[model samples]
Target: MRQWLKGLALFVAITCLVWVGVLWYWQATSRDMSPEDIALYLGLLPLVVFGLALLARWALRSAVASAVAKEAAAAQAPASGSPALPSAGQQERHAPFKLLASGLSCAAGHSAREVADALKEGAPRPAPDKALRDDEGLPVLCARIEPLDTAALQEAWDGVCAVAQADLQGAEAQPVAVDEAVQRALAALQAPLQQCLSQLAAWSERFAKPDADGPQAASAAVPAGLRVFTAWPTHWSPAERAVAQAWVKHCLKQDSADWLAPSQLRLMPSTQGGGVALWLEADRALRAAQREGLPEVVLLLSCQSDLSDARLGHLQREAALFTHTMPKAGVAAESAVALALADETWPELPDAAAAPVLLHRAAVIQRDKPIDAAGRVSAQVAEQVVQQAAAAAELPLAEVSALVSDADQHSPRGAELFSVLVSQLAQLDAAEDTLVAGTLWGRTGPTAPLMLVALAAHRAEMNQQPCLALSVDDSVARMALVLRPPAAAGAEPTKTAS
Candidate 1:
């Protein structure tokens, strides 16, 4: 009987353990995922795995090919047929430098001073009906450039180019050692883009409805206006095609640029390919300035009239960002901002008209958790970025006389941003004034940070004191830059572009 009882007890213990395990699993699953979700995961898992595997295979193949090529080149170099190494002078390089001159084209104002003044005194208010309140009951507004069409873009491009050209004399004229590979890539990309536009122009004649003039005029028009319904039959959308066509045309217009040089460094706007092409030629000019041993200037400009269509102000379906009645996380405004950089190696010019703007220091850091995530923003990364910038500038936080940021004052993100800034302010030398660039220019898209840079440059020139520019990108990187008047002067300006 005792042996039978022991066996029963053993079975009961085993049964209890099994039940406990099942209960624990169910509890976990209650919070997230169900049988339906399981099926969805199962369907997606294969694609994800396949993508990862494909990437790995490509990387392995590339690495192996590179290794084999390097071996072959090494083996060939000792032979009689191998070419000799190029001389140092034949290989060109450039270091970072400060801005000698700056130009801005923004909807906020024609120049940085106007934009700064307007930003401080308060920009004109948007129509009450146009503003949307976000999930947190904060209003978001946007500033736009009047007429978001090609003419506006071309004009803005011309204005910025003129500024850069005037300040960076001979930058486009500066000789560059052509990189054959880069030239080939540029040509390859440009050729396809041109062809795409030409095709669109041709197809446009067939699909477009007759306008006031006649059907014949449609041939001159690009396929971008065929309407989404009409353009859907084609592989790509009209909107995408229009952006590409505009970019390619813009590139071809920059005749002053050395076409053979490598593509220049560009600060990409907020999204993947979000008009990064807009700065392609400008990148070339900036590179030329670097090659010519000239002071570096960064120009950040944007006009957002194009974004007024949704009038929702760059809204997304975040639960907390929208209310049943309104969306408040965005603003509409225009802005033009500029900055002059100062490299430690370059001497500051004496007898300067005003203390030239100098980039005292800058820092960027990735957040542990994205600020845009569902959780409360830690802002630790932002604080670290600022601290690093201050440390590099050798200035205390108290000395940050002014603050410029792309964040609007009305969103939850804005509230978190201000909270972070306030916590940091207690550690600063003097309380700094805040300028929400977006509040003045509306959400300027990628121009948000550019506007901040421009504003800092303006304040540095005006107060002859340091200004701090802070910004966060969709990539979860927080950046802080300190702009101040040039500490000293150097040599005469180099040959500049007309």
Candidate 2:
């Protein structure tokens, strides 16, 4: 009200000054003019001009009001049969998955704890690649993982080959040989996969009977019906994908306390939607397992590396997608992330000591427009997914403590994500409450979404509050999910796992 009054007073003062100036000009220029001519030129003309200005201001206000009303109505309307805002009871019917453990191998660090710490310290920065350059003869910036020990990877590869050969002994199948490139990719994935499976094995051992005699007894105590969902790069060939799948299965068998046999393994390889899609599939698989009375433990894993010169050169040639400018272009990166998800109802799960981090059902939707198009990109899809995720968790947007996203410095992606955050979570401080994974890990390819999830889980556990994880790196789809933590803990937790 005070501001409005001040504006009105300023307008009146300006109008009075204009009228006085006109009157003085009329008198000075035409001293011989009649009084009637003076009144018509000075009084009436000024009055008419003031009235027109007022009329224009009113018209502009009305148009703005109308647009606001239309946008509000559209936001209230459901985009599909599943309402954007579900009631608490409706949300409760959809059970959330418990995030038992997570592992990460990225430019930042080798474990979830290390990665989280590195993020806190801002350790990983996009640096110029020594071997890759853009069209302008400038080095391309990238977040690169340090090269692994070749001898160790080779030893692991030999074991994997032995396991594969033994498993296929009598199946009347031809031998599968993976190319050097695929083997390199598999080697990149080995660290995170081993770390995640080892964590799960350790967790299971915690609940093993005190009287259990040996390692076999602890292995027997490990949960059955384990499922593995792996997301690979779309560029991998059919043979490469098959070999990668075999490698993942063998890794699981080797790390899973000897309880997860090759015959009992259920491996699903996904080449699209990255880690977000894997989480969605894991959710569905958990629900199906519940219905069939199977164990609900599942592992979601993904890895991608663009550190190679060939990959970087290809990105440079694709000028439309990448550029020499750091802020506008997507930075090439290498990363691997693995998450262990389990149903809370699983008898083998030690409920008392489990970290209270729940991954709510993810909401995913496709954007109607291309990401790189000019003009304002509507935040409707992104907003809807966020609302749906919060609703599924039975939590209000206001209660969300932090937001983690895969949005980079690229304008379109950042704009879309910022629009949603500003509109839906008005209480959040942009600088303090938001974390962008791309800033730290660059563009992590298929590993991005899960990496965000792992980070969100870690943040929630540390803050003892809910954190939102958003995946907007996809060209046509937006994904969101909420991670809820316990209301209280003795101190800040170091990792997402129990």
lDDT of 1 by residue, 1-498 (tens): 996787567555655655565557767778475787555454444445455655886899999999999999898875857455544332221122354444444445545676777776776544332434434555443344432224433344444344434433435653322222212212223322233233223222322434558656655432111100001001123333333233333543442132211222233322232222223233444555546655333332222322322334234443222233435444434333222233434343444455446664356666677565666657677778788777656567887777777665555547756765778765443223776665555544444555566667777767666778887533365777777665421222211111
Candidate 1 segments exceeding 4 Å error: 1-97, 105-107, 128-141, 146-328, 332-352, 427-432, 473-475, 488-498
Residue lDDT tens for model 2, 261-342:
4545677755465666676788788877866666657888887777665666666666432554535667777788888887
Best by lDDT: 2
Query: Candidate 2, overall lDDT?
Result: 0.72
> Which segments of candidate 2 are over 4 A away from where they belong?
1-93, 135-137, 156-184, 203-223, 257-263, 325-327, 347-356, 487-498
Q: TM-score of every model?
A: 0.48, 0.71
What does the lDDT read for residue 392 in candidate 1? 54
Q: How much is the lDDT of residue 440 in candidate 2? A: 71
